[model samples]
Target: MNIKLIAIGKTDNKDLENLTNIYQSRLGFYINFSIEIIPDIKNVKKLSEEQQKQKEGLLILSKLSATDAVILLDENGKQFDSVGFSSYLQKYMNSGIKQLVFVIGGPYGFSPEMYTKANGKLSLSKMTFSHQMIRLFFIEQLYRGFTILRNEPYHHR
Candidate 1:
């Protein structure tokens, strides 16, 4: 199965983008992987929190294909260890899924419509993180998860 990460806005920090690129390249060796960036909304200062989320949610939903399985990176979502995450990925591959889409929402988080559309939700940590930082963290963990699955030396218990 292919994996796709969809996140709101671009990472402005050069260091973070570079590090994320490294993991993205490493991931390509194991499977089909891609990151799609949804442009940040314009005139954000004019919109209410709910309006912003609603707008972002519409954009997020538009990127999804009918067959894609979406998993939101939500603060309240399920948390799993590295090995368990690998197993989770394995299950999807075994099931013959076409694409697994994981989304990192905007500043105020996802709207109700987004929550309803998601197949499941995953939490990287109980603590909050910047949306841009989460991209790097998630990609690295994904790389680590694949390494664990393949018995590579990159990951250890």
Candidate 2:
């Protein structure tokens, strides 16, 4: 199955972008991994938190197809260790799904409608992280997950 990471905005930090790219390239060897960035909402200063989430939700939903299985990377979602996450990926690969989409929402978080559309929710951590930083962290976790699945030496017990 293919894996897609859909985040709401771009990363301006060059370091973060480069680091994310490193993991992105490594992920390409194991899965069809792609990062789709939905541009940040213009006039965000004029909009309320809820409005921003609503607008971002529309954009996120627009990128999805009916067949894609969406999983939101939410702060309150289920937490898993590296091994468990690898197992999760293994289960999806075994299920014959076409695409596994993971979304990192905007600054304020996901709208109620977006939450409704999600098939599952996964938490990278309980502590808050910048929207941009999460992209890099998630990509690295994905790389680690795949390596663990392949019985590689990347992940340590």
Candidate 3:
């Protein structure tokens, strides 16, 4: 199955961007992987939190196709260990999904409409992380999960 990560805004830190690129490149060996960045909403200071989420949600939804199985990276969602996450990826592949999309929403989080459209929600951790940092973390985990699935030494038990 093809996997994609959709996130809001750009990563301003060069180091983080480089690391993210490294993992993203590694993922290409195992699956059709790509990252799509939805530009940050304009004039956010004047918009209410709900308004900002609503606007960002629209952009997120626009990136999706009707057949995409969307998963939101939400704090309150289910958390899994490295091996478990590999199995989760296998399950989706076994199910024959064409595209599996995971989204990292804007600061205020996903709008209600976005939640309604999601097939599942996944949490990287209980602790909060900056959106920019989360991009690196999530992509690395995706690489790790693929390695684990291949029984590679990249992930040590």
Candidate 4:
């Protein structure tokens, strides 16, 4: 199955962008993986938190197709270890989904509509992380999960 990561805004840090790219490239070897970055909202200073989330959510939803199995990367969602995550990936593949989309929302989080549209939610960790840093972490984890599935040495038990 194809896996897509959708996140809002660009990574300003060059190092983080480079590292995220490395993992993204590695993922291509195992599956059809891609990241779609929704440009940051302009003039956020005037918008309320809820307003910003609504605006960002609209952009996020626009990237999705009706057939896409959308999963939100939410802090309050289910958490899984590396092995478990690999199995989770396996389940989706086994289910024959065309594209499994994971989204990382904007600062104030996803809007009500986004939550309603999502098939599920996953938490990388309970601890908060900057959205930019989360991009790198999530991509690396995706790579690790695939390696684990292949019984590669990339992930050591």
lDDT at residue 124 of model 1 (Cα atoms): 98
Q: Ranking under TM-score, best-scoring first? A: 3, 4, 1, 2
Instruction: Tell me how many clashing residue pairs each candidate has.
Output: 0, 0, 0, 0
Model 2 agreement with the true structure over 1-157: per-residue lDDT tens digits: 8899999878999999999999999999999999899989999999999999999999999999988899999989999998999998898889888999999999899999999999999999999989889999999999999999999998985
Residues 15-113, model 3: lDDT tens digits: 999999999999999999999999999999999999999999999999999999999999989999989999999999999889999999999899999
Off by over 4 Å in 3: none
User: In candidate 4, what residue range of length 10 has the lowest lDDT sum?
Assistant: 148-157
Off-target runs (Cα >4 Å) in candidate 2 are none
Task: Please provide, for model 4 over 42-114, each residue's C-alpha lDDT reduced to its tens digit, 9 standing for 90 to 100.
Answer: 9999999999999999999999999999999999888999999999999999998899999999999999999
Model 4 compared with the native: what TM-score? 0.98
Local distance difference test scores for all models: 0.95, 0.93, 0.95, 0.95
Candidates' TM-scores? 0.97, 0.97, 0.98, 0.98
Q: Per-residue lDDT tens digits of candidate 1, residues 1-157?
A: 8999999999999999999999999999999999999999999999999999999999999999989999999999999999999998888889878999999999999999999989999999999999989999999999998999999989864
lDDT of 1: 0.95
Worst 10 residues of 1 by lDDT: 148-157
Candidate 4 accuracy as lDDT: 0.95
Q: Cα miss at 128, model 3 (Å)?
A: 0.7
